[model samples]
Target chain A: MLNPIEWSSGPDGEIPFGTPFPFSVPFALASPESPGLYLEGVRRIKERGGRLVSLWGSWTSGADPAVLAAFSDAEGLLLYRFRLSADDRSFPSIAFLFPLANRLERAVRDLYGWDPAGLSDQRPWLDHGLWDGPPMVPQDASFQRSPEGADSPQEEYPFVRVEGEGVHEIPVGPIHAGIIEPGHFRFQVVGEKLLRMEERFGFAHKGVRTLFRNRSVSDAARLAGRVSGDSAVAFQTAFSDAVEVATGSPPPRRALWIRSILLERERIANHLGDLGALGNDAGFGFGSVQFGRLKEEFLRTNARIFGHRYLMDTVVPGGVAGDLGRQELALLREECARTKSDVLELKTIYDEHGGLQDRFSGTGWLDPMLAGRWGLGGVAGRASGQMYDLRHSHPVPPYDQVHVPVSISRLGDVSARVQVRFQEVRHSLSFLDSVLEALPEGPFFIQPEETFSPFEGVGWVEGWRGEVLCWVRLGSGGTVLDAHCHDPSWLLWPALEQTVPGNLVADFPLINKSFNLSYSGHDL
Target chain B: MHKILLKIFRTGTLTEPLPEPGPPVKPCPLVRGSLAVRHVDAGSCNACELELHAFTQAFYAPESIGIRFVASPRHADVLLVTGPVTLAMKDALRAAHEAMPDPRYVIALGDCACNGGIFRGSYAVSGGVPEVIPVDGQIPGCPPEPKRILAYLEQLVSAENKD
Candidate 1:
């Protein structure tokens, strides 16, 4: 079985390749619907304790859309590919077996119009009637992308309704009050208490998958980084690693070490910002100021070291775009030391503040059993006892070399999520402290030769939110044929609905911020 | 409370001066030195929004310079929009802009908002914010830094306020 307890015994370190094993035989189900290889493949993986990391669909010029599901277990990643005939536009939906696949399957339908057979929720996901046809298909291929897509009225979303005494609905925005990304939230509430909450996204979809199609490796990496923007380094790292894998060009050991520095810095910056936001959401304005100042300082230091504050496009194919020399490393260490104590002090304030604690504790409680069943990945997952971190379990290079600690909790409340952030920041900073001492000496970036033959690659990185997975196929002369960058938010957003009900309607923002699910990441 | 105050004292004030304004905007004395801005996210990657949040911190105290981010478009002098205007958000952006009171200015805050930056040809996006609604000015960057964003708003305020 594929338990997460053992190390990956695969040859090329975790990522499995060759013609996927699912296609070895027809593997039909006895039921009349049969559901075929797709259902059976997911069922087997589920039986072996595999978590649905990501599910995406792609199509070639002549062929119809083919769906692929990625499952993560002790063996790193196991991929299931089911190529459908041009006639049958639907495939067996695995949402019933693995609940996390629900939104993903819906999204696949929205993008490619491929039906997830027997999916309960058939509502439009990313297609807010923006485009007439599947945007994933090229203009010359399956269907034409109508220029007058705006002429079509958006389909009315079918939000689940709840009725009772004093039960009313509150619909909050695609254009939210705050300067955050757009997403709609429908709440079924009685007075101040929420009975049910359903999230609606796709207000931020920019067709990044289609944009990624014809671009070169460099441009594709940049586009991938923008898929969420905040997780630029994570996306860039994942994409670059994917391309590296496809081309069979792993960068030098020093490059991998430097990549780790950028990754940790990205994590710390985001954590500092989110921690502050969480405190503010919990009614602590002081938390915003203190942590905001610290985060600003952190970003300024990033701009000094790497040209961009968010370190966008820093990690490219083969290696990173830049390196940290002795001087840069020294500056980073000094900043690290300064912020480390400040974060500690701020954490103390957040911990000791009775008001903050009262608001955080028991707010947005996600049951541990529900969490495990859904296979939540990332920080929120860790808080809810999912207890999986790619850095520790499936280490790639520098992570493999160094000891990466995972912070876990079974509380599964907003406070536990916040607590996980604090501990994680501490862990990341310590990782930086240890690694910055002696960055291996070598060339930072390696230029890879272009390949005309088609090759496939997959990359999984422990992003700030959780595991960000990228799968890519390179066409002639280093061009991207098809690519899908999967965000950890895909799993967490559905989990957000579970956290909100039974909590105060007003605490939604605080709870939402605690999880900090990415609307852009999810929508894209 | 004592520790909080002490910490505040230790940190002190880190606010920087808003830059002297220069622009081609029509000068008006109405609501001089004070502007209520409503920010709308059409379809940004949230990088623009991250920088927008910098206004809340000590170093970039936006209220000190008389710029407040209002929640409603009804109580605003300007509408700040970010990202490429995705097809789903076109109507919502229009509705928000229409909701704003007269003599309102709509400024595209990033490259994507200005000319659809990198998300231009995607089937999901209609175009930049300008394509969806008329824009008075643009602050273009993948994401303009906090200082530049502050500077642009200052220009608008300066133009609005008579000497």
Candidate 2:
């Protein structure tokens, strides 16, 4: 069950840390727990086998800057708010306990200069020394980067060196050969075999924290949707859920169901694309063409029904942007059924093909132990024997009524990921069918209050990749004070780094495509 | 292989003719019938990249129209840049342009590439493609659809000489 957020109170009845602050989603609060207490809280959560979902710092106006960590459990999403004094330079590091926290901790350091105490890996993660310093405090509108700030990271970055006979380094991209987001990969290899695949991302950091500040709810939602364009619906849903929680405005049941429909459609479309891409990466261009055509047709249908290709901005703050008529719902159901059977045929081809099977069966294997240790979940996690699914584990709102089947595989390779995607597409299709069977009727959107008192809330949804969280703190007059949108890619990127070694270097693309982790989402 | 061939044969080509450019579309000065383009994602959110990939998929089959997305900038005649130019990517964008051979044209894709788009005033982004490298033309939209993108590219496809 969800552990209640521990919030203490001062003598004057101000919420100082036992006073429970209510959150609109699943419910939790922010109390600046001391370092010792914070450590104790995190230890308890870890003991309970809670997975670290997201970790970010928030500095709202008129309040002490605080660092927060989100942990997922049976109860829902539990939060830990650790208070940081102005003089404090570091906080207790959970990276030692949770390996996935390592990169996020480094990101916090780059953005807020708050280093995780007692952590050994001090290499900068998100910051490339492109800016003057950590962007913790917002700069003036006219702030400028120093002339020398543009020094090439290729010249300065210390990619962990490997010294041995026949060990050579192949540095690839911040700009890749194909049309994908930018991120550098430093592969230490012996001939065609990979020794280690170290990555340096953050090439797509468009300053989410800087952009989220002082923006209206609608503007913030739009920005969140753009965080990772592929998962636009998920990001906006989480963003909207966060604001609705903070502002105490909940959408009608009808909107919630519609939001889920959009989410499932988005899932189906993405998985369809990935199915083809995974095939293409393995030199099976035929699979790419077949799936790509299917996905394009699906997206075209979405444009006709939802008025947007990626379903961007469709899930707004209070409710959906627009309600679907009976005709649109019928159209969606027809498309879902068609795509489901289309994928089943491809699945047969994948299963029966010897060459594709040979290349995919055991390539880029990730063991179950590593997946669990790093708290990997979603498609990749399911492929690696981690069976946790947010829709099943912790059902939020309409999900409680809609049962979502978790498709899992233990093989933990490129093929396993492919299998998981295919199954998930089927699962989403059934879930979508069930959702559309009976349409609820009510006001789709309820306008939020024009102004709001300073309040912090969090919302998360199980996106196609994995679960994504958006933490928001509203300032006076309904403007955003601080916000952080954490993508599941943050956790998977490191998990992916572990999957590549000992595999042939050529299989890297196949492995990477199978997971298809988001470079832009993680960088943001 | 026969089953695969049968499957491929059953699913006929879905490729369509490129949409004709509107009147405001200008002809590029470069004399070319085909384009060998290189893509550099300066700092895109990946939406534009997604559409670009869609443009190359079976539904579009851009190669049938003589458009090839080359691997290296050195082999490119046109540079397709996406997203707002981030500070980290600015040098790389400029470097990619410098690497391209003479008479190389730059086409900024998406609203972000055109003028920084949604992430305009952020500290990390240094505006759009024009800020880092000279841009010959731009395709606009949050992410211009594949049809719209092909129409924009079609403007540069001259009927004169073959590469």
Candidate 3:
């Protein structure tokens, strides 16, 4: 029912809008009219029931500054591209329409030196003043060491103040007590009740985007896998998908099935760890020990079946690197069955446990409307009644063969998040079994051509956390011109900010653990 | 309750035998005691943290070998550092290292901390731990497994004892 129409161009140049494919549609706009067209395009997508996935900017040496935005719609994905001339470096902000665009715009400004003119929170997002200038400027090599004395006199971050009677501010670390990534959180509190929570990330930003430039497609896949360690499989697959699409090479069917298997395994392993951590934060040590043991078992299985415990480097551009034999398949089948039953029992125990219920239910509530407005996805979104899953909604290759039942709840609290994870673990187990059962017969990998024509490709995968969208533009001979890998954490991080208010200070950890947005993923 | 207790009993203890210590390197009393580690993630993909978390889990219980993670660097005898040191986290890493008491050993876990791994020369990163703080030992791998980490700790402790 939603009609797709092309945008008109001005005197500058006509924007090229590619034909919509089954998976993704690619379009481009010129600098002169991009501000109006970009806003109109975003509005049209939302009108057509699409949500923004990610928005990023890239700076290449020869080409003009480029901005790419991805949105998920009922049909598939809508990718909007805008090219800005050297003379004109500003674009009207879309943050007013989409609140999630605030951080993305800030990152674009800090990294590529592009100005999003109308952005609300123009305060520096990732630029902690640790460096001298915009790193991604084409003239300056983005990876050089800072000037002498640049390290001294760290810049003070201006956190928004909420002043009132009995109001106090609590600042938590860039270095936490647990073995986790570094991220600072500033909480405005009146007694135990949280008035507001502001998050400052980028302690883990290692200039991953800068490293992606000029690398070969194969080499860049490895960097993509490490974008976020937990979502390594998803990130690698998405990167490979983009490269493959750009090069016009579809991987072998068997390779697709194997990639799905690895993705499901990664999902199960992370869910087990999170469920255990959530229980532990709620004062249930038994749950932690038991679930921790189960996760260890799963990781061991990954090592035995695939080469790496984290399944890193198993998915390459052409296809996957590893294959499962009969013995491995049998072992996995038995393990999957066992894990499912055990997890079911654990879920039952959690539901019956009164103390955990008291801690989980109604804590860190995220309203469904807020979740939709923010375009939240993955487990967090599903818990909040957003039934959008890339696996189910946008079924690519192997996922089309196997049905992925979306597990959604309306509670939008810690309890709902836990329940959604529980349901997903079970669903992933079943999905794995089906894929392994229908494991096709073919080569695990196909060699890609040595050189590829200049083209752009978009890859989207539903990682355990949520949808991870990757965009790659390959020049002649497979040289990467620009690559933007956007993690789902970008959208969910702000949602965590919203959920923390009205909850007690003591419940912050539990609420935080429930969302568990990847600081490294977001920071990157 | 009984079922849960039975599940624990059936699982049994997951303690693994520690590797044989190398000959003592010097006459240091600190080597005789257990090693307490304070972990700092300068900038990593968190794959190393996953392996480290697994090291504390039941399977490769590092505690059985006198290696346990502490909350504070002051209580720590060893600083277990992971990831390529990002510019934002460099100061924090230095502060954590300075907070540690003397007789401290810095162990760079995973390839990132050893020599920046894949993220070397990144715009926001200053390579590895040694770029900011001195490292006493290095464990290599995209993420070295739990057993590998424990073995490295054993060797460090043994060599210190010899001294």
Using DockQ as the measure, which candidate wins?
1
Per-residue lDDT tens digits of candidate 3, residues A347-416?
8888988999999999999999999877789999999999889888868767887998999999999999
Q: Which digits, one per residue and each the tens of the lDDT, describe model 1 over residues A249-295?
A: 76777888888899999999999999989988877888899999999
How far off is each candidate at the interface, as Cα RMSD in Å?
A: 0.8, 0.9, 1.0
lDDT of candidate 2 over A1-524, digit per residue (tens): 34534442322222121112132236454454578777777777788887899898765556665678888766666777776666655777888778788888878877766667877877778888776676765443222332222223435677788899999999998888988889999999999999999999888988877889889889999999899999999899988887777676767788888998999889989999999998888788989999998899988988888888998889988899998888888988898888888788888998998889999999989998888876789789999999788888867656788798888999999889999998899888999988898768898999865444576557888999999898887876888888889999999988888988899989998899988888889988
Task: Kindly report which residue stretches of model 1 are placed more than 4 angstroms away from their true locations once superposed.
Answer: A1-35, A62-64, A142-154, B20-29, B159-163
Q: How many Å off is the CA of B126 in candidate 1?
A: 1.6
Provide the lDDT at A1 for model 1.
43
Q: Alpha carbon lDDT of residue A224, candidate 1?
A: 89
Supply the TM-score of chain A against the true chain A for every candidate structure: 0.92, 0.93, 0.93
Please give, for residues B1-163, the per-residue lDDT of candidate 3 as tens digits.
6666766787787666775543432232466546788999998999999998888877677776677889998988888899999999999999988898997688788999999899998879989999998877788899998878876776654544454
**TM-score, cand. 2:** 0.94
Poorest lDDT segment (10 consecutive residues) of candidate 2 chain B: B22-31
True contacts reproduced, candidate 2: 0.81
Report the lDDT of model 3 for residue A70.
Answer: 73
Error of 1 at A410 (Å): 1.5
Q: What is the DockQ of candidate 2?
A: 0.82
